[model samples]
Target chain A: MLKGHQTWVFASKPVIRSASAIGGPFEAKGPIAEDFDTLHSDLMIGQDSWEKAERTLLEEACDKAIEKAGLTKETINFFLSGDLMNQIVSSSFGARTLTIPFLGLFGACSTSMEGLALAALMVDSQSAEYVLAATCSHNASAEKQYRYPTEYGSQKPPTAQWTATASGAAVVSANGEGLRVTSATIGRVVDMGLKDPFNMGGAMAPAALNTIEAHFRDRQLPYDYYDLVVTGDLGRVGHSILSELLPKHQIEIPLDRYQDCGIILYGDNPDVWSGASGCGCSAAVTYGHLLRKMKEGTWKKILVVATGALLSPLSYQQGESIPCIAHAVSIETE
Target chain B: MLKGHQTWVFASKPVIRSASAIGGPFEAKGPIAEDFDTLHSDLMIGQDSWEKAERTLLEEACDKAIEKAGLTKETINFFLSGDLMNQIVSSSFGARTLTIPFLGLFGACSTSMEGLALAALMVDSQSAEYVLAATCSHNASAEKQYRYPTEYGSQKPPTAQWTATASGAAVVSANGEGLRVTSATIGRVVDMGLKDPFNMGGAMAPAALNTIEAHFRDRQLPYDYYDLVVTGDLGRVGHSILSELLPKHQIEIPLDRYQDCGIILYGDNPDVWSGASGCGCSAAVTYGHLLRKMKEGTWKKILVVATGALLSPLSYQQGESIPCIAHAVSIETE
Candidate 1:
C-alpha cells in the first residue's frame, strides 16, 4: 500500500525472524557491546587484507543469522546486501561464497537499513519466502579507501567520526514471530553544498531531516508516534542539527527519545571524536541493541532513519558536492 | 509472484511505456547510432569532466524517457539507476538533479536490465504507478578509473573491449500499451577462478550461463521459447563460450537466433577490439535498438540476460578472482 507520498505501507508487515551482529575490538568496547553476538580481538580476522577481513565478517554474520533462525543457507531466497567498499566487493565476494541470489546495493553508510527495508519489501510482497539483509564496515578498510590509512597518524579535524568495524545481518520472512516491519519511506538525494569530507554529519543531517519529515507527514502521524526515532551514524553534530531543524519543521518530539546510533554506540568516548560512524554503526546497533530492547518489552514501536553521504573520492577530488539521502523504516513488537 | 526457486512471475506484467537512449561520440558512429534518441558529437558532451558528462547523459535519457511517455517527471514514482563509477556518483548525482525517490543500484555493466527488472517488479506489484530505469557509462571516465587515462595512448590487448559512452532509460508503468515484462530471474554470483580484468566477457559468461539456465528451468520453458536470447556485453569470446556451455548443459537452441549486446553494438569494428562493453553497452542497445525492432514486429517474446563482471579496480589489485552475475528479464508484445 502507498502512503501519501514517498512511503510504502507494508500490508503484510514482514517479520524479522533472526538477526546477528559481529563487532571488532573497537566495537566490542562500545556502549552496546553486550548486544553483539560475537566480537573479534583483531581486525584482520586471519585474512591477508582488510578487504578480505571485511568479507569474512559479512560471511560470519550471515551464517549466524540463518543458523539462529533454525534455517540453512539454501532456505534463504535472496541476499540483499551492500557495503562502503568501492564496488561493494565485500558483499559481492561474500555472495560468491554464500551462493544465494544476490542484489548488490551501495548507499554508503545507510546500506544496512536500506538492505533491510528492501528485503522486507521483497518478503512482504511474497516475492521470496526468506531474504537476507546485511552490511559491514571496517575502520581500517574505509580509512585506507576514503582517507589516509590509520598508519599515517595524520591529524584529523574535530568533526571527523570514528568508523566502526562491525557487520550485521537479518533474516526477513513472510511468517514469523518476531519484530515486524510496518512501513518504509525511501529518501531522495539532498545536497546542501557542504563540501568538507570530514564533516559528514553536517552533510548527512539535512537528508535525515528530509526523510524524517516526509515519513511523519505522509503517515499522518505526530513526531511522538514512534517510541524512538533514531538516525544512523549522525554523530553529535548532526544530532544537534536535527534537534534544531525538527522544531522548525513543526515537529516537537522529546529530544530524549530522539537519539542517534552514532552517538549512542560509544556513549561519550573521548577518542571517538564526534561518534562512531559507518554502515556497521547503525547495522550493529539496530540488529543488536534496539532489537534486544524490543524483545525485552522495553520499547513498542521505533523508527530508524539510516542516512548516507553519497560522494566518491573522485567526485570530491573533482570538486563535486556531496549528495546525501536517508531511508526510514518503522519496526514494532508483534 | 514467486514462480519457482529464483524467478518472479509478475502477475500484472508491467509495461515499458517509453524509453530513450543517448549515445556519445564513439556510440554515434556505431551500428545502432540512428536508433538513439540523441547523440553527442564529442566525448565530453560539453562538460568539464567525464563524470559530469556521464551524469548529463543519464539526466537527458531519463528526461527523454518521461517526456516521450507524455508524462511529467513528477508522475514517475521512483528512479532506479547505477553505473561503473566508484560509489556510483554519476547515478547518485544524476538522482540529485532528477529529484525522484532514488534507489541507486550497482551491478557493474548489467545495471541496465537489472534496473529494468526491478522497476518492472515495482510497477507490476502496484508499488508504484511508474518507475524509471536507467544506467550510463562514459568511456573516458571508466578508462580513467579502471585503467589508464585516455591521453596515455597505451597499447591495448586484443582481449580488451571498449566501454561504450551511452545512457539508456525506460519508463515502466502499471497501465500502459507497450512491451510487457513477464518474468525475471535474479542471478547468483558465479566465479570461475579467472583473474584477468581485461577479459570481462570471459569472466561474466559463466554467470550469464547460470542465470539463463535457471530462468529456463524455473519457468519450465523450452530453449526456443523466445525469438531472441541476448546476453549483455559478452562480446565475441564470451558469446562463443556461452554457445559451447549451453549445449554442455544439455539446453540446445537454434544458434542463429542468439545475440550479444557487445558484439552487435559496433558491428565488426576493429578499433573496438573484441566489442563494446560497459553499463551503457547493453542499455543503449536494448532500450533503443532492440525495442525498436520489437515495435516494428521484427520479433517477439525475447529474453534479455544482462551480465556484469563485479570486479573493482581495488579487488583486481587485491589479486582476487573476478565474481560475475547476470539478471534475466522476459519482454514480449501482447
Candidate 2:
C-alpha cells in the first residue's frame, strides 16, 4: 500500500532466503573481508580483463546465493541486476549464464536496493515465486570508464572515494525464513549544484538525506523503529553532511547507529581517501556484514539507504550538476 | 496471477491514461511525425550542449504526459525512466525537475517496454495510484559515448542505424480510459558471440525472437490473439532475421501485422542505413503512433517487444560478445 507521501508499505513482506558476496584483493584486505563468501587475491581473478572479472564475480555470487538457498537458477522466476559499467554489460553477461528472465536497472550506486525493492515487490505481489537481486562494481573497470585507467596512474584527489571491486547477490522469495523487506521508499532526484564528479559524496549527500527524511515522514515512524540506519556509500564526507542535516530537519537518530557502508568497508583506511563507494559497496556490506549481524541477533530491524550519484563523464565534462537519488528499504528479521 | 514460466499476468490491468512524444528535427521529418506531441527544429533545442538538450527533451515529454493526463507531478507516485546515455543522466537529471520518485532502468532500446511493464506491474499491484514510464535518446549524445563525437563524422557501416533525437512518456494508472496492459513477458539475456557493436540489430535479433517465442508459449496464444505484433528496434536486419527464424521455431504470424519500430519510424530513408534505433525509437513509435492507431481503431490489440543490445565501449574494446534481451508487453482494448 502507498504510505504517507513516497513510501510503499509491503503488505506481504518478501523474505531474503539467501545472499552471497564476493570481493577482489583490495576489498579482501578491507575490514569487512571476513563477511564476504569469497575474496580473490587479485583483481583479475583469472580473467583477462577487469570487466570479465566483474562478470565472473557476479556469476559466482548468484550461483552461491542460489546454492545457499538450496535451489537452482531454474527456480528463480526473474533476475533483477545492474552495475556501474556502461550499458551494464557485467550484469547482462552474467544473466546470459543464469538464463533467467532479466530486467536491467541503472541507478548508479543505488542499484543494490533498487534491485532489492523490485525483487521484493515481485515476490510480494505473487508475480514471481523467486527473484534474484544482485549488483557489482569493479575499481579498474569503473576507473577506465569514468576517469583515467588504472594503468594511466593519474594523480588522484583525496576527495575521491575508491570504487569497490566486489559483487553481492540475494534470493528474494515468499514464505522464506530470513530478513523480510517491510517497506520501501523510492527517491526523487535532487541536484545541489555540485559539479565535481571526484567528490561524489558531496553530490550524493542531499539525495540520501532526502530519501531518509521521506522514509521517516511517510512511514510516520520515529527513529527507534529500527536498530540502525545505514547509508549505501556516502563515505566520510557525505556521512558528516547527513549527520549535520538530519538534526536540522528535526529528525533525530542515535549517532552510533548511523553508519555508512563506504566508511565501514575499509575501516578508516587512509588509502581509501574519503572511503569506499560503489554499487558493490552497499551490496557487499548489506548482504555480507549486515546480514551476519542480523543472523547473530545483533540487529532485528534496520534501514538501508542507498545513494546514487547520477552523472556521466560527458555530463560532468559538459558542466552539468550531478543529480542524485537514494532508495531506502527496511529489513527486519522476524 | 502467475501465468507461465516467465510471463506476469497483470490482474488489475493497468491502463495508459495519457502519453507524449517529442522529436528533434531529424525525426520530425520521419514517417510518424504526426504522432509526436512536439517537434523541435534543432537537435540542440537551443541548449548549449547535447546532453542538456537530451535532458530537456525528457523533461518536456514527462511534463506533457502528466499535463495530458490532467494531473500534476505530485499525482504521479513513481517514475521509471532510462536512456541510451551512460549512467542515464538525462533521465536522472530530468527526474530532478519532475520531482517524482524515480527508478532508472537500462535495457538499451528495450527500455520503453521494460519501463511500461514495470509501471504496469506497480499500478496492477496497487503499489501506486499512478506511474510514469519514459525514455529518450539523442543521436549526438549516443555517438559521443558509444563511438565517435558527432563532429568527428566517422565513417559508419550500412548495417548501422540512426539514433533518434526523441523522447516518449506514458502515464499508467489503475483505472483509465485507454488501452490496458494485460500481461508482460520478461526476457533472457542471449549472447550469440556477435562482437560488432555497430551492428546492434544483428546482435539483438535472436534475443527478440527468444522473447517473442516465450511470450507466445507462456500465454498459450496464437498469432491471431494480437492484431499486431511489433518488435522494438530490431531494424531491417533484425526484422528479416526474426521473420525467417519464427517459422523455423514453429511460430507463425502475419508478416503484415508484424513490424519493427526501427523500420516504421523512418520512411525507408537511405541515410538511415538499416533503420532508426535507440531507446526513443520504440518508445516514440509505440506510445505515440501505435497508440493513436489503437484510438483510431486501426488496431485494437498489440504486443510490443522491445529489444536491447547490452554492450559498452569498454566491452567492445576488450573483445566481448554483445549480450541482448527483449521484454514484451501486451496491450488490449476491452
Candidate 3:
C-alpha cells in the first residue's frame, strides 16, 4: 500500500527467499570475495566478449538463487533485470536464457534496488508467487562503452571509481521464511549540473541524500530505525559528501552504522582511485556480504539505497549535466 | 488478481484518465497527424540535439496529458518511462525536468505498454493515486546509435524500418472515468536467433505472436474478444508473418480488427522502406489514434501489444542474434 509520498509499505512483507552473487577475477581479489556464491578466476568466464561475460554473471547469479530457493526456472513468475549495458542487452539475453516473463529496467547502478522494489510489490499485491530481481555490470564492458577500450591502458583521474565486474540476484516469494522486504522509496531525478562522468560519485551524491531524506520523511521512521544504512556504489568521495550533507539537513545517524558498498568492496585497494562502482558493486556486496550478515543476526533491519548516475557517454559528450537517482528498500527480519 | 501464467487481472480496473502524443515533422505528414496533441514542424523542436529533442517530445506529451487530466506535476505520484536511447537518456532527462519520482524501464520498443502495465498495477493496488506512463524516440538519435548516422545517408535495405520521431504519454489513476485497463500479459524474451538487425520486424514477429497467444490463453478470452488487436511495429514483413503464423496456432483474430502501428503510420509513403518503428511508433498510434477512436465509441475494447527488438549495435557486431519481447495491455470502455 501507499505509505506517504513515494514509499510503498508492503503489508505482506515479501520475503527474500534466496540470493546469490557472482564475480569476476578482479572481485575475487576484493575484501568480500568469499561472500560471492561463485567467482571466476578469468574475467571472461570463458566468454568471447566482455559483454557476454557480463551476461554470464547474471545468468549464474539467477540460476544459483533459483536453485537455492528450491525452485526451477519454470516456477518463477517473472524476471526483473537490468545492467549497465547499451540497450540492456545483458539482461535481455539473460532473460532469453531463463525464459521467464521478463521486465527490463534501466536505472544505471540503482537498477539493483529498483528491481527489488518492483519485485516485492508484485509479490505483495498477489500478482506473482515468485519473482527474480537481478542486475549486473562488468568493468571491461562498461569501460569500453563509456570510456575507452580495456586494451588502451587509459590512466584515469583520482576521482574515477573502478567499475566492479559482478552480478547479484534474489528470489522473492509470497510465502517464505527469510529477510522480508518491508518498504521501498522510489527516487526523483536530481541533477546539480555536475558534468564529470569520471567523478560520478560527486555527481550522484545529492540524489542519494535526496532519496534518503525522502525515505525517512515518508516512512515516518526515526533516524535510528535501521540498524544499518548502506548506499550503492557511491565511492569514497560521494560517501564523505553524503556523510557531511546529512548533518546539514538535520539528519543524524551513528557513523558506525553508515556504510557504502563502493568503499567496502575493495577496502584500501590502491588501484581503485576513489573506490569501486557499477551496478554490480552494490548488488554483489548487499546480496552477498550484507544479506549474509543479516542472516547470521549481525543486524535485524537495514536500508539499502542504490544510487545511479543516469548519464550515457553521449549525454556528457553533448554537454549535458549528469542526472542521478536512488531507490531505497528496507529489509527486516522478525 | 493473478489470472494465469504471466497475466494479471486488475479487479479495480485502473482508468486511463488522459493521453497525449507528440510528433516530429515527418510524422506530421502521416495520415494520423491530426490525432497527435502536438506536431513540431522541425525535428529538432528548437533543441540543439536529437536526444534533447526526444526528451522535449516526452516532456510535452507528459505535460499535455497532465493538463488534460486537470492535474499538476506535483499531484502525480510516480512516473514510469523508457526509451531506445543508450541508458535511456530521454526518459531520465525528462524525469529530471518533471521532478517526479521515477522508474526507468528498458524494453527496447515495448516500453510504452510496459510502462502502462506497471502504472496500472500501481494504481489498481492502491500503491499510487496517479501515475504517469510515457516513452519517446528520435529518428536521428536512434539511427546515430543503432545504425549509421542520419547524415551518412547510407543505403538501407528494403527490409529496414523507419525509426519514428515521436513520444506518447498517458495518465493512469485509481479513480477516473475513461478507458480502463483490465488485464496485462507480461512477455517473455523470445529469440529465434534472427541476426539481421535491418529486418527487425522479422526478428520481433515471434515475440509478438508468443505474447498475443499467451494473452488470450491466460485471460481465458477468445481471439475475437477484443474489437481490435493492434501490434506495436511489426511493419509489412513481420505483420504478414504474424498473420500467417496465427492460424497455425489455432488463433483466429478477425482480419478487420488486426492492425500494425507501423503499417498505419505512413500509409503509402515510399520513403518508409518497411514501415515505422522505435519506442515511439506504437506509443503515438495507440495513445493518439486508437484511444481517440475508443473515446468516440468507435470501439469498445482493444489490445495493444508493444513489441521490441532487444539488440544493441555491440551485440550484433559480436555476432549475437536479436532477442525480442512484447508486452500486451487490455484497454476497454464500459
Candidate 4:
C-alpha cells in the first residue's frame, strides 16, 4: 500500500530467494572480493569488447542467482534489468540471453535498487511468482561512453569516481525462505544545479538524502529502526555532504550504522579517487556483501538507497546540470 | 493475477483517466494531427537543442495529462517514463521538472506501452492511487544519435523508417471514469540476427509478433477479441513482415481490424520512406488518436503492442545483432 507520498509498504513482503554478484579483475582485488560469486581475473572476461564483457557479467550473475535459488530460467516470470550504457545495451543484450519476459530500466547507478523494488512489487502483488532484478556496469565501457576513452588515459580530478566493473542479480519470489523486501521508497529527481559530471557523488548526495528522509517519513519509522542504512554510491564526497546535510534536516542516522557502498567497495584504494560509483558498485556490494552480512547475523534489517546521477554526455555538453535520484529498499530478516 | 507465463491480468482494472499527445511540426501534418493536444510549428519547441526540445514535449504532454485528469502533479504518486536519448535524458530532465517519484525505463520505441503497463500494475496493485506513464522521441535527436545527423541529409534505404517527433502521456488511476487497463503482456528480447540499425522495423517485427502471440495465448483470448490490434511502429516493411509471420504462427489477427501506428501516422507521406517509427509514434497515436476514437465509440476494446529495436549505435558499430522487444497492453471501455 502507499505510505505517505512515495513509499510502498509491501504487505505480502516479497522474499529475495537468492542473489549473486560477478566482478572483474579490479573488483577481484577489492576488500569484499570474497563476497562475490564469481570474479574474473580479466576485465574482458573472454568477451571481445567491454560492453560484451559487461553483458556477460550480468548473465552470469542472473544464472548463478537462479541456480542458487534452485530454479530454472523458465520459472522466472520476469527479468528487470538496466546498466550504465548508451541505451542500456548491456541489460538488453543480457535479457536477450536470459530469454525471460523483460522490463528494461534506466536509473544510471540506481538501477539495481530500482529493479529490485519493481521485482519485489511484482512478487508482492501476486503478479509474478518469481522475478529477477539485475544490473551491471563496466569501467572501460562507461569511461568510453561517458568521458574520455580509457586508452586516452585522461587525467581526472580527485572528485572523479571509478566506475565499478561488476554485476549483481537477485531473485524475488512470492514464497521463499530468505530476506524479505518489506518496503521501498521511490525517489523524485533532485537537481541542485551542479553540472560537474566528474563529481557525481557530490551531485547525487542531495537526492540520496531526499529519498532517505522520505523513506523514514513515509514508513513512519524511527531513523534507527534499521541496524544499518547504506547509500548506493555516494562515495566520500557525497557521503560527507550527506552527513553534513542530515543534521540540518533534523534527521539523525547513527554515524556508526550509516555507510556508503562507494566508500566501502574498494576500502581506501587510492586509484579510485572519490570512490567506486556505477550501477554495479551498489548492486555488487549490496547483493553480495551486505546481504551476506545480514545472513551471517551481522544485521537483521537494513535500508539500501541506490543513488543515480541522471546526466548523459550530451546533457552535460549542452550545459545541463546533473539531475539525481535514489531508490531505497528496506530488507529485513524475520 | 497472472493470466499466463508472461501476461498480467489486472484484477483491479486500473483506468486511464486522461492522456495527452504533443507533436512537432512534421506530426502536425499527419492524419492524426487533430487528435494531439498541442503541436509545435518548430522542431526545437522553443528549446536550443533537439534533446531539450524533446524534453519540453514530454513535459507538455505530462502537464496536459495531469490537467485533463482534473488533478495536480502533487496528487500523482509516480511518473514512469523513457526516451531514445542516451541515458534517457529527456525523461530524466522531464521528471526533474515534474518532481514526481520517477521510474526510468528503456525499451527503445516500445517505451510507451512498457511504461503504461507498469503504471497500470502499480495502480492495480494498490501501490499508488495515480501514476503517470509517458514517453517521447524527436526526429532530429534520434537521427543524430542512432543514424546520421540531420544536417548530413544522408540517403536512406526503403527499409529505413522516419523517426517521429512527438510525446504522449497517460494518467493511470485506481478509480477513474475512462478506459480500463485489463491486462499486459511483458516481452522477452528476441533477436533474428539482423544487424542493420537502419532497418529497425525489420529487426523489431519478430519481437512484435512474439509479444502479440504471447498476449493472446496467455490471456486465452481469441485472435479477434479486441476491436483493433495495433502495432507500435513496424512501418510498412515490418508491418508486412509481421502480417505474413502471424499466419505462420497460427495467430490470426483479423486484417480488417489490424493496423500499425507507423503506417497510419503519416498517411502515405513519401518523405517518411517506410513509415514513422519512434518511441513517440505509438505513444502519440495510442494516447491521442486511438483513445479519442474509442471515446467516440469507434471501438470498445483494443490491444496496443509497442515494438522496440534494442540496438545502440555502439552495439551496431560492434557488429552486434539488434535485439528487439514488444509489450502489449489491453485497454477496454466498460
Candidate 5:
C-alpha cells in the first residue's frame, strides 16, 4: 500500500485547446479547455472565478486516478491537494464530493512532490495505508496572473517559464505495487536576492543547482547514480544558468540527460514561447512521462527536482527582489 | 538532528488583526503593535519583483529555522518547502543560502503540512535522519491573487474567511527534541460541486464537516478523543455552518471545544467583518498558540484540520462555482 501516490507535470497529453489552457483573473474565462468562448466573459476583466474551473479539472483527475488505482471513493482516506486559488478551489471543491477527509496543499509547482513526500511519511509511519498528492496549472489564467493575457501578446523572456497548460495527479500507497519514494531530500530556501519575477528561471537556477548537488552528495551517490535528473520548468535561460553553474562547481551532469518542464512542454512547438512553468509543469511531466518510464523499467533511479519562485504582485510592488528555491526527491521502482 | 528550519510573519503585528478585523491593505503596514498610521505607501502599485520578496522571506525564515534547529549550511541534507507564488518563491529562493537539494511544493495553505509530511518521509525512510519543512504567507499578496485586493473593497459575505496578515513556520526532524508526525491521515477530495467563490465559507463547510466526521470514523476516535478539533480559517459564517452541520449529522462535537483561526485572531472586534482565512491564519495559530499548548502539556491530542476554499477569481468569472476541501491530521504531544 503506497500510502499516497501523486504526480505533477506540465501536461498529461498535448493540449489541443489553447484558449482553455490559459487561466487567471484577467483571462476573461477559465482555460480555453473549460469552454472559455462560451463559459464566461468576466475572465477577461479579471472578475472570473478560477476556483470552479480548477475544481472541475481536479474532480475529473481524481476520479480517473481512483478508478485506475482500483479503489472505491469510500476506501480512500482523504483528499489532500491544493492549487493557486485564494482558498485552493481545485482541491477543496473536488474534495466536497468524497465522504472522506481532505487536505488542501499549496507549494506552487512543487506541490506534487510535497504530496508524495507526505504520503511516503504516512506509509513509513504506518499512519495510513494510502494517500493522494496532486496539483494543476491553467495556461490562460496563469498567464493573466503572471504576465499579460493572450490579448496583450506580451513577449516572454527566455528565463520566464511558460505556465503549463495542464494538470497532473498521482496515487501513492504502501503496497509497493508502484514506484516508491525511495529517498526524499528536503531543500531549504537559498536567496541570492535575485530580483525580476519575470526572470524566475534565472533566479531559481542556483537553488536547483544546489539541491541536485546536495542530493547526490548526501546519498553518497554520483551524478550518474540515477538515470535522469529532472528540473521543473527552468525554461531556456535558467536551464543554461544551471548547466553553467553545475560545471563551474566541477559537477558535470549531462545537459541532455537532465530535463526541464519549460523545454519539454513545447518539444518543437512554437506556441509555447520559452517553456512551461507553474504547478502543471512538474505535475504533467511526472505523471505523463516519468511514471510511465518507472513502470516500464526504462529508468531505475530518478531525481525529480521541482523548483518554484515564491513572489507575489505585492512583493513586486514593494520593490522587493525575487528569491528562488527548489526541492529534490529520488524515486525508484522495484 | 533537525535538518533545517525557517519562519517569517508580517513585519507589522497588529493587535486587532483578527478574522473579523476589517481594514484596508497598508492600513496596518508598519509595525502595528507599536507603530501605526505609518503605512508603506510605495506598495500601492506593483513595483518590485515578487521573486525578490519571496527570496528574502524564505532566506530570513530559513536562517532562523536553521539556527534554532542547530543545523549548519553544509550539513543540511536538503531544503523542502512551498508558498503561494506561481513558482514557489519561498522554497526556491530560500534554497540558495542553504545550498542544499531542494523540492518545492504547492498544497496551497496545506503547504506546511506538505513540507512536514515530506520531511517525515525522508527521515523515516532512513534516507535522511535530518530534514526540514517551512511555509509562509503574505496577506496583501494572497488577497490580491485569490480574493479582491483591499482596494477592491468587495463586500465579503459572512462565510468568507479573513485572510491573516501574518506568516509562521516550523521544522520537522527525526531527531528533534519536539513532537513528531506521530500519526497522519491523508485525505482524498470529495467534491460536492458547490459553487460561489465569495462564499467559500459555505462551499468549504461541507468538506470540513465531512473530513472531520470521517477522521473520527476512520480512526474510531470520538470527538472527545482530542484536546481540540481546530479548523484553519473558517470565518464566523462557516464556523456556524460547520457547527450546525456537525450536529445535524448526529456528531455532536462541542462547538466551544473547536477553534477557528478567523475567530481566534479577532476576539470581539467586528472590523474584520468575516473570520480569518489564509495560509497564515492556521499557520500562526498552530505554530504560535497550539505548539505552545502542546509543549506546556495543556493540550495533548490535537486534530488540526486545515480548510481551504478552492476558488479563483478567474474561475468565478468563468461563471463557475466554488468547490471546497479540508485535510485532517491528528497531532499528539507524546
Candidate 6:
C-alpha cells in the first residue's frame, strides 16, 4: 500500500468512509465509471520464480500502503504481514522494500487478524505511531508450492479454499480518522492433530471458538456487542462446525451475522465446497468488504478472526497432522 | 549462532576492537566450537526438512540474541532478517517465533548489512529504541531451493563459494553495549549480466566493488582510513576480482586483507577451491570473524560490505544472467 498501483486504484475514490463493519451493502473502492478494472504490478524485472512472484506482491503491497498513508517509510514503526508460503515470503519481501524496521508474522489463513492484533498492541504500547499490517495470497504460487498445480487436476475438498491471486494491505495509524483496532486476543495454537489439509476449516473451528470465547470473557462484552464476527477462510464445513460448537461451548452468536471468506468467494456458486483460505483471502476480503462497510456505518463493532494451519510437507510425510492457530481483532468506529 | 547439533565445532569470540571488518582475518563463530554442538528453537515444534531445520536454526539464533539484549517478544521494536531460500523462509520462521513485529529483508548475501542499515535508521528516527536486525542462512535449504541440491552433485565452478551449513544472528539495540551501526550507504544493485549460478562469485564482485567505492566516496573516507573493508561472501574467485577491481577504481585495500567466505571455509586448503557464498557464507563470516575482531580489539573502523547474487532457476531458464547487489555498513565498538 506504500505507493503502488493497487492502492492508487482503490484510494482514487473521492469519497472515503469511516465505519467499523462491512454491514452496509458491499461497495468496491474507486469510481464505478473508471476504465481500469485491474491493478497489477509488473513482475517482469526481478521476479522469475514463484518465490520471486510472492516477494514482488509483498513489496508492492507495502510500498503502495506506505505511499497511501503519506508517511515516510522510515517513520512507519513495525511491519506485520503474513502469507501462505512456507515461511511467509510475502511479508518478508514487503519488509525488504522499505528501510523501516519490521517483523514477520504467521497465522495461516487467519493472518490479517494476527497482524491486526499485533498492530493494536504496538499502538497501545505507544511503541509505534503507525504500523503496516498486510496479508497476501497467490494462486499460482500456492498451487505449485502448497497444493497441486493446475495441471495436476487434483480434486479439492469441500473445506478447502482457493487461494486468492491477489494481495491486500492496510496502514494502521493510532490517530487516523478511521476505524481502530480496539482490542485483540492472541489465540492459542491448538492442535487437535487433524490430518486433512483439505478439511482445515473443521480442524480450525475449535481454536477460533476458544479465542472468541476468551475475547468476550476478558472484556465482559456480550455477544450482541459485535454486529459481525468473521472467521477467515473457514468454508462451509468449518462454519457449520463452529456454529454448532460455539453453542455447545455455551457461547452463542447469530449465524446470519457470521460470515467466512470461503463463502464469500463462491458467491452462491456450487463449485466451492466450503470456502477459501490463503494468505490473500482475508486480506482482500477485509480491505474490500470490511473496510467498505466501515465507510457506510451499518454496524458499530466487528470482529475478524484469522486461522492458519501449521504443517510442512515433511511433517505430513512423517504422518503428522495439521496444528491450527487463530488470532482475533476487534475493529470499531470511535 | 544458535543451538544446533553437528555444528559449532569451533566459534570465534566477539571481541570489542578487531571485529569491525565483515570479511577480514577473523575467527568463525560456531564452526570452531567444540564437537557435537547443538542448535534448537523454543517456539518451533518440528524440523524434519532441510527448510525446517534452517528455520529452527534462524529462529533460535534471533531468540537467543533478543533474550540476551533484555527485550521481550513485545518489547523488541521489530524483527529484521533475510536469506537466500526460494521464498526466504528462514527470516519468516524467525519472525513467527519471536512474535516481535518484523520485516523480512533481502539483499541476498548483503542481507546482514542491509538489515543493520534499516535498524540504524529506525533508531535514528526515534521510532523505536531497540530494533533487532538479524540475518540467517543455511546450506541445505539454499542449495535445494536456490540452486541444485548437493544430492544432484551439480558441478560447481571455481568461482563459486561452498554454501556454509550454518545460521548466524545478532541483535542491534540502542541501549546495549555492542557495536553500533555507525554509518550505512545503501548499495545500488549493479548487474554485470554474468550468467552462471555456479560462478556467482564473479557476478557479485562488481556490485560489491560498486558499493565499496560508493561508500568511501559518499562519506569522503579514503582507503587505509580504516583497518579493513570486508566484503561478504565473494568467494575466492570473486575476492580476487574485487582486489583487482578496487585498484582500477583508484581505491586500494590490501590484498592480504581481502577475503571471501569461500577462502575462509577451508582456510588455505586447495581442496575447497574458491570458498562459500551461499546465504550462510556471509552470515557465518560476519557473526564469526567480524564480531570476534570487535571483541578482541585487534582492529577498529571496519567496513562490512555484504554482497548477494540475485538469481533464480526461472531467471536462468530465461537466459538472464544473475544481477547482484551489495549493502555496506560501518560497525564500530560502542
State what share of the real interface contacts each candidate retains. Answer: 0.67, 0.79, 0.81, 0.83, 0.47, 0.02
lDDT of 4 at A45: 94
What pairs collide in candidate 2?
Answer: none
The positional error of residue B5 in candidate 2, measured at the CA in angstroms, is: 1.3
TM-score of each: 0.99, 0.98, 0.99, 0.99, 0.71, 0.66
* lDDT score, candidate 5, position A153: 75
Off by over 4 Å in 3: A1-4, B1-4
Better of 1 and 2 by DockQ: 2
In the range A1-334, model 6's lDDT, one tens digit per residue, is 1110000011111111111111100112212111111344443224666656666666666666666677666666556666666545455435545534444445566677766665655455444566677777666777777667779799876567666555667777656667666666655546676888678888888877877886677666778788999888777888888989887888778777888766664455555556566766666667666766665897677888777765655446557566666667777766
TM-score of model number 1: 0.99
Q: TM-score (0 to 1) of chain B, per candidate?
A: 0.98, 0.98, 0.98, 0.98, 0.78, 0.84
Off by over 4 Å in 2: A1-4, B1-4
What DockQ score does model 1 reach against the true complex?
0.65
Whole-model lDDT, candidate 6?
Answer: 0.60
Worst 10 residues of 2 chain A by lDDT: A1-10
- Tell me each candidate's i-RMS in Å: 2.2, 2.1, 2.2, 2.0, 10.8, 14.6
When sorted by lDDT, best at the front, the candidate numbers are 4, 3, 2, 1, 6, 5
lDDT per model vs. reference: 0.90, 0.90, 0.93, 0.94, 0.57, 0.60
Candidate 3 lDDT over A57-136, as tens digits, reads 99999999999999999989999999999999999999999999999999999999999999999999999999999999
Q: Per-residue lDDT of B133-215 in model 4, one digit per residue for the tens?
A: 99999999988888877787799999999999999999999896999999999999999999887788899999999999888
Worst 10 residues of 6 chain A by lDDT: A1-10
Tens-digit lDDT track of model 5 for A102-182: 555555666666666555554454444556566766666566565666797777654555575456666666664666676
TM-score of chain A of each: 0.98, 0.98, 0.98, 0.99, 0.81, 0.84
